[model samples]
Target: EYRLTNPPKPPATVEVMDGENRKHTLQVQVLGAEETWHTPSLLLASVGSSGGKVVFSQIRTLDPTEDVKQYGSTLNRNKICDIAFYQKVHLEVDPGQYESEETKFQALQKSDKARLEILQDLLSSHLGLSVAEKQGPLPAYTPGYFLGRHELKLDFLSALQPRLKADNILKLNLLSLQFCGKGVEPSKPTASLMPVFLHACPQRFSTVEYFENLHSEHIGRLLIFSEVMTSSMEGLDGAVLHHGLAVVACQQISGAGRSGNAWLSPEGCGMFSLQLHIRSDSYLGHHVPFLQHVVSLAVVLAICSQAGHEDVDLHLKWPNDIYVGDCIKVGGLVVKTIVDNTMTVCNIGVGMNLDNNVPTTCINALLRELKLAPLSLEKFLALVFTKLEKLLVTLEKGSSGVDQVRQLYYKYWLHSNCEVTVIGPQGSKQEVTILGIDDFGFLQVLAKDGCAFSVHPDGNSFDMLRGLIAPKVK
Candidate 1:
């Protein structure tokens, strides 16, 4: 009966020297079967030596064979040892005797090192930043850097901190510093710096309280203006040039609402705020600026749709809001245009409640209902800029530019066929059938009296329409 036993462990090293002083050492361990067997015999033979001379080692066996005649014999002759078993026992040279295999392995290692260095150089050059290597209990591959030119705003840092920490490969947080040219400046009473910008809201704080709460130490010179202006400040520029910065605020105009803010800089970059508040009880003015703002927003939505593998169904509500479903507001865009004698600069603020759901009336709430992952603020901001840049370039060409924006707006407006109620001046409510938006980006509504009046000629008429308390149906 045949029985299985564990094979002997192979030798660790095998080497051969020159012909005269060649040495061979074999170390092997075998676990034999427990059962007692008949006497076992072992035979050893070597052929094809360097000089073609046969070399044989003495046979060793657990028990001596009684029938052993000569070195060569035919099979079935127990008395004579057969040469067939040992005739062709030629020991071949080790397969790895040549240096080709070692050479290939070394070459592969060198190539891998070179490839990694190239990738690291490319990454550093593309980011225009240097990464500092870190050593600690943290991940070995984490890279860290200090950010220049741009400081992290409070809101941005709050949202980004957690995500960066969660990535096991990122060890250190990015540090941001202000753009101060090389070398420290000398203290001087008259030296002043140009302001960058500021943002504040009056409804959130009164003018006196706002100024008092300004964290003066961090305020720098640039001041942002919001809804705290009155007629008393007319023709008076509130900017104060001090220590390489400018401090400025808005001129509170009469009839302007209590919310919204402005950004001011000495470089002539100014932005105003237009806030839209909609609740279950009220939808205020369908303003002209608001429509233009919504058009800018739609351009962003179009780009996002193209980027995703599946097309997202995105559309706009008349006047100033974006909606994805039955009367649900998903996102909003605020446009503050500062027009001076020289130029008009519009600062567009887009706020999207990516993950939050407002069940009663919000676009974010609808997104949750569809079971889609919330959009990240960083990705959304990047896409918005890309889309805005394209739209602004197109708009610079004149009236033709406006026409293109109008076309895109009309294509995305969801309720163009529904009856829309227009609230005219002084509490007058006019229910008109929706026709379409005109070239000037105005809502062309056909009144019940057979008159077609442009609801928002310059974009301000929507304010009246939005103020009505009840939804007007056809």
Candidate 2:
């Protein structure tokens, strides 16, 4: 094994040219607690990382093989499994393969390992320069925590894993490292220590208590946080938020989804629910359905503005979805309204792929691909709040305002004029062309025979001919 200490600055890029002149460039970075290896070459299968050291790693095949079963037993004690638990480090980065975890995971499935010689050369070339760059004393750099393939050792995580697993978050920060820490205190935002979603408010405050002045407003009642729990919304609902509340959570144990489906509570994704009690005669209660559209639009606008581009191709899937570009379901909203006393409580939950956690949906990665810097999570939240306030005011105008909101949403509708195959409950498939969305938000789809029908959110679903549905990573 090659031991190289005191490496140069993080994300040090090095290219290896061997006897055959086969060249490969490796970008080395020191992660907080995630060990990741990525490359485009078939020769270098993978390299291992542990104790803050890079070792010879056997590539992890996406398809479950015999080794997967063995990973839990004898193989767990083997060298491959040993490398599974490593320190903070990143071996390679291909920003081009950026997308949601699901899309990239599909690419991983077809990957084949490189020859041992290629991987060895790739390591020796990069590591040799890493050592050469630092000719001084070694530093006491160590990780506070470590993660194994099947096991993890962390005081705070043990108490939270059960609940996270219950919500189908099998892999926390599966792609990137958001939701990778506890949350920010009622203080300024730190990249690794703060809650990116609501770091700062429109008030310019950078802490939990920062949303204080807004506490006087109907939108800002209480911003609750949990060291371990199910969800931010659930937490608020549990407390019976009478004054209205926006509960933010770093990790969600059990998440709710549409049609009684369980939503995945990922650590890094922005997961929160805003509950506002809209009275029967209130402006918002009369337009509850349109409120969902406004929230979704608000999130899209927030992200688009952050990208410094209004033409980022973000779209609404009617009801509540924020689709980025053409392939990724970046984030979405789940609106559940209830009658509490004589008021209608609108529980508007918003989520998104924020950072490295959801690479595909990560706003930063998307911007990076477009050659732009990422907008800080704190600023992003502040922008969202600002836009949301305006949207709510427009929706409260009754009919005309509602029509304007619909038009805005329609301008970004993802399925309009697209070919889609609707699959009925009986597994029957019929191809149709989406004309547009109805005034009520249901999809207006046209069949080949020229029959137009309104498709509501239900058991029957249509597959858009535009994007591919890759199987999700476990």
Candidate 3:
């Protein structure tokens, strides 16, 4: 059986040629089919340009062979996936079956790999020391605590309330580092120690320098790392830097995506994870799933807040994907939460192609096209935090705050009033119109026959290309 993630529109006309060279034309509207089918059969295909003609040839004879079970299994394997294109493009091959084109493609691949290496080098150089040297004992240069003057750290300790002050926030930072160390690969012992470290930070910093009205404790504590297995795993268990610790990385070797998928993390990608602590009885606690929505809104609003970026057409995909200019994803969010008796520690991981171009387009690439200055990573992050800080306040205000967020989400989302086909676990299908998100962040849709229901983001995968909502196979 063929499952078309992007199926052709209705009124698809098919032309068939008989063995006697006779031809017949038929118009077909494919609605449904068997969920699974197995058979060795000949397949015919065609390629063409958009708004152009495509023709398929007739098969003179039919033959059945043993099923290629290995090929099917390989296709079903769970692995990292990347989006490279929004629409199909046909390639014109030269006489030698594009031998020259193949050679050029190989050269381009090498060039991309080399570019990524250079970016990695730049990230290391940003710290003014090599990874190997930093790992060595008594390294020539080691960042001081909080990368600040000792007196400033003392001042921050005194300013905190007695309870948090006694807890010792600096000690918590050390515990986070130790937690990360245990999770690193045994082969790369230095990876745990050298790359990740505390940088310039203060418990109470002035956001007036960047943006205003943001009163956040942990969000501004920047933890810069050269590389890591994944930012999501850092400071996860144990004493996490919870007021809102920002863990930024140059690159993630194995970044995370929704449903255990892999996120491609190379240099030029703005990869980070924010760890925040909230009360279980708070307004946010009841809507834990909406954290991704909050982050998603913060990203687009952050970018648009800049002077020249006010007109940048950034949008949020359902749940937590960020898209720029027609289905080209530029960023995404993955959230994880651990709940205690009365508090919830949430980790929000974000990966954005701010300057990277591999897999798909980046934000800077779009800026360059618009003749606008590219955004600096530092300022962009500050804006996101500012927007997030403000949005979080709304969540803290109860249902009214959630309604405000939902209203703003609808303003920037791509699926408002969108028509999609929802496929059920039993191979059932229904056409639904997306209304908005519910209180719990699940997609609220109105199906035909005047039925209304919500689709849980975790249970269904939304394929915007073909407007499909299918069960998420674990």
Candidate 4:
């Protein structure tokens, strides 16, 4: 099953090689000590490696999660998920020709180091790499670097302008375009980041540079205003109607959180507001919350691609939040719609903490994942846009399309079946275990007594952290 929110578990024993031909077993305090349902499932495959070859077997690094042990003894302890396909094969190892099942089980310790390398590679390839070439070297941020750069804002295009026309792996041109081959070779480690482009952020219009890097189908235009006086959404929607979207600011300011609270959007935060057009009778209209799902998932994947899959503890907090670990929030989504006659413009606002832009408390920064390479703003945006475009195509397929989108959503859901507080139909708070999400984006939750229920976001505020609250409260 896809247990993206389950933390790494410690193996029962680890095999180590000593100076002389010696082996030792060591116990590592991984994270979650829970069984099946509380964590991800590892599928065992037999590889013919002998017992002596393994080192570092016990503790598995994070594919993702909040240590299950922290919220100890919740409603369903070690609850193995019954949902089909929800559990994915995260790790696979051969039992090493053991005669007994118990011995075979113990044999898992034999392949720790080898398995970790495999896992890290998979994580890096799946999450970190970018599409085209890496943009020019990110320069150090000067104090007023973005204070007044009106010339960088892109011209709004009325329709997509296809840059390339092929369907194959692209080889980026590192010297010129940012999305080219293997991305910019990893930069030497740095202790400080420029003020405007932290996270090794790319300069303003890397999107255009991507076309120069490799060729592909047309895409929506992105007007990248280096810095703006107000929210990008305001800039886009406030103007008479347009055909494309705008990134709030290469660095945003004065942004508002979902609760109407002021969002701390200092320089270096990947704060952008997008204006996407939704059909009058579009699937997005019926599945409004799915937009959040799509946007959050897009951001999550982009982060994984840049931050190294397990680098930062990232989570797709149900509904609309992107969290790191359990308590720290790293990214988010906020959407607003404007009706222009028959056309509907969906305004999306997003924020992610990059490098020093992170909040002191209640937040975690991707930059903290010391071992992983940091992403340039251009690379981060390219990764997200690429994935999002593919997803939107799939989502446009109707019911079947909707199912695909939802399945991907479920695979990365923060706490797919965990306990959360939700308001009952009568408007009082009640705890419910999110069974999963249904067709229309409503959450299927299970109450303590085993009664089944569904929670909608229209009249309710549904969150994995807190079940469901009044709509106004969210």
Which numbered prediction scores highest in lDDT against the true structure?
3
lDDT of 4 by residue, 1-474 (tens): 235344434355556664233666554332222254454233221223432222222334323223344444452433422221223433555454353677655766676555555566443543343233323433332211111122322222112113311321111221111111123242221112112221233355454554342221322343434443344444444433333444445544346767576776666676776667766676775565667778888777666644345555677766677777665677777877766555667778877775444343222234543555556555565566667767777888888988887777766666666777764555566777778777656668888898997776556664434333444543
Q: Model 4, residue 340: what's the lDDT?
A: 58
lDDT of 1: 0.36
Q: Looking at candidate 3, what is the lDDT of residue 198?
A: 31
Q: What is the TM-score of each predicted model, taking all chains together? A: 0.37, 0.50, 0.61, 0.52
lDDT per residue for candidate 3 within 1-474, as digits (tens), equals 332243223335666673334565654432222222221111222222222222221212211111223354444322201111122111222123444687766655555544444434433543232433222222121111232234543454455334342213223322223212224431222323322323334332332343332345446443333333434345343444435656655556557788878888866887777777888888888779888898999989887767777778899899889998657898998887878888888888898999888768888888888899886566667778878988988888877888888888887899988999998988688999999998888999998899999999888888898798988877
User: Model 2 over residues 1-474: C-alpha lDDT tens digits?
Assistant: 212222222335556663235676654443222223322112222223222234433323322234455555554333343232223222343323554677765564434122223334554664442223323432221111111112222432364455443222222221111223345233222222222222223232244433421313444333444333455455434323333455555455556766556666554666667776666776666545556777888878767755366656677765576777655777777777677657787777777777644435676676777777766544555566667777777777877987787777777777667777665544455678778766555677888999998766533333344322111222
True-structure lDDT of candidate 2:
0.51
- For model 4, the superposed segments whose C-alpha errors exceed 4 Å read 1-220, 305-311, 340-342, 360-370, 424-429, 448-452, 458-474
**RMSD list, candidates in order:** 30.4, 17.1, 14.7, 21.7
Question: Which stretches of candidate 1 lie above 4 Å from their native place?
Answer: 1-291, 294-304, 307-311, 358-374, 397-401, 457-474
| Per-residue C-alpha lDDT of model 1 across residues 229-341, encoded as one tens digit per residue | 22111211221112112112222223121134321111111112222221222111222343354445544453445433133556666555565543554555444444444
Better of 1 and 2 by lDDT: 2
- Note the Cα lDDT for every prediction shown: 0.36, 0.51, 0.61, 0.51
